[model samples]
Target: MSQQSSKPEAPKSGGWIKPAVEYGPIVLFFISYKIWGLMPATAVLVAASVAATIVGYLRAGRLPWAPIITTAIVVVFGLLTLIFHDDTFIKMKPTVVYTLFAATLWGGLLLKKPLMERLMGTSLKMDHAGWRKLEARFALFCAGMAVLNEVVWRTQTENFWVNFKFGSIFLTFLFMATQLPMIKRHMLPDPAESESKGAAGE
Candidate 1:
C-alpha cells in the first residue's frame, strides 16, 4: 500500500496581499519622485491612492476607513501641491496623518479602550489589559514619529524627508517584528477552555 503524504497548508494569499497592495503605491511614489520630481510624483501617487482604494473595496466588498481617509487626504494635498506649485503641502501630509493617528491611539488609551484593538479586531486575540498596554506603546511610538517627521522636514529638504519617510517605515516594521515575542508572551490563554479540554482528555 502506498503511504499517504501530509503537508502543512500554505497561508492564504489574502493574508499577505493587503500589505503589498497598501505599500505598492508608496513605493511607486518614491520611484517616480526620484525620476520625475514632486509634482509628477504626486500626480502618480494620487492615481495610485485612488486605485488602491478601489482595489481594497472590490477585494473586501467594503471600503476600509483608513485607506479611504488616507486617499482623500492625499488627493486634497496633492491637488494643493499642483495648484499652488509648492511641495510643502505634500511634505506635511505624513506629519498630519501621523499626528492624527497618534492622537487617536493615545486618546483611546485615556478612554480605557485601545484603538488598535478595534482596528485589528478580527485578526488577533488579546485581553483588555494586553490591548490597553499595546495601545499605550503604539501611541508613544506614533507621537515620537510625528515629532521626528516635523523636525526632519523643517530642518531638511524634500528629498531628505522622502528618504526619511521610506527608511523610517522599514525601521518601524523591524521594530514591530522585534516586539512579537513580547506580544506572544503577554497574550492571555483561555484557562477555563484549556482546563475543560484537559479534563475531557483525561
Candidate 2:
C-alpha cells in the first residue's frame, strides 16, 4: 500500500480566499450590528453564514466540519432569537459553539483520535505525540474562549460582546502562530533525504 504524504499542499487557489470565506460572515454580522442593531444583524449573520458555507463547499468540494457546525448553531439560535424576540439566544451561540469545540477536541484526544492532527496535519506535519499535545492545548483554549464568551455576554453590553468576537479572531491567529515552533520541532524529517544521507554514510 502506498503511504500518504505527511505534508499535503494547500489548494492551488489563493491562500487569502480561505480566510476571506471563513471570516466574511463574521464581518458581515459585525457591520450589520453596527448599522441595523442586533435583530437585523442576527438575520444577516444567518444569511451570511449560509452563503459562506455554500461558497466554501463549492470551492473545496467538501464542507469544513467546524464552520458548518457553527453555522448550524447560528441558524438555530438565530431563529430562536427571532421567535422569542430576545437577543439572548443569539448571544449564547458563541458560548455553545466554543464549548462544543472544547468538548469535541478533548473527547477526540481521549479517544486517541487527536482532532488537531486530522484538521491541521495537511499543513503542520507533526508526529502523533505532538498532535496530542497540540490538541490538548487547543481544547483548553476553546474552553477558555467559551468561558470568556459567557462572562462577556452576561456581564457586558451587546456591543462589547460583538467587539470581543472580532478581536478574538486576531487572538486566535496569534495563538496559532505561536505554535509554529512546537510544530517545527515535532515535524518528521523528509524520508527521501534521510534515506539519501544513510546511503551516503554507508
Best by TM-score: 2
Q: Candidate 2 lDDT, tens digit per residue, 51-136? A: 87887777766755888898899999999998899999998888898899999999999899998788767655779999998889
- Tell me, by lDDT, which candidate is best: 2
Estimated TM-score for each candidate = 0.84, 0.87
**Candidate 2 accuracy as TM-score:** 0.87
lDDT of 1 by residue, 1-202 (tens): 2332211111233454456456767888899989998899899888998888777666656654666777888889989998998888888887777787788888888887788888765456777877887777777777888799889989998898888877876867876887687678767677779999999999
Per-model lDDT:
0.77, 0.84
Which residue pairs show collisions in model 1?
none
Prediction 2 global C-alpha lDDT: 0.84
Which regions of candidate 2 are displaced past 4 Å? 1-18, 192-202
What TM-score would candidate 1 get against the native?
A: 0.84
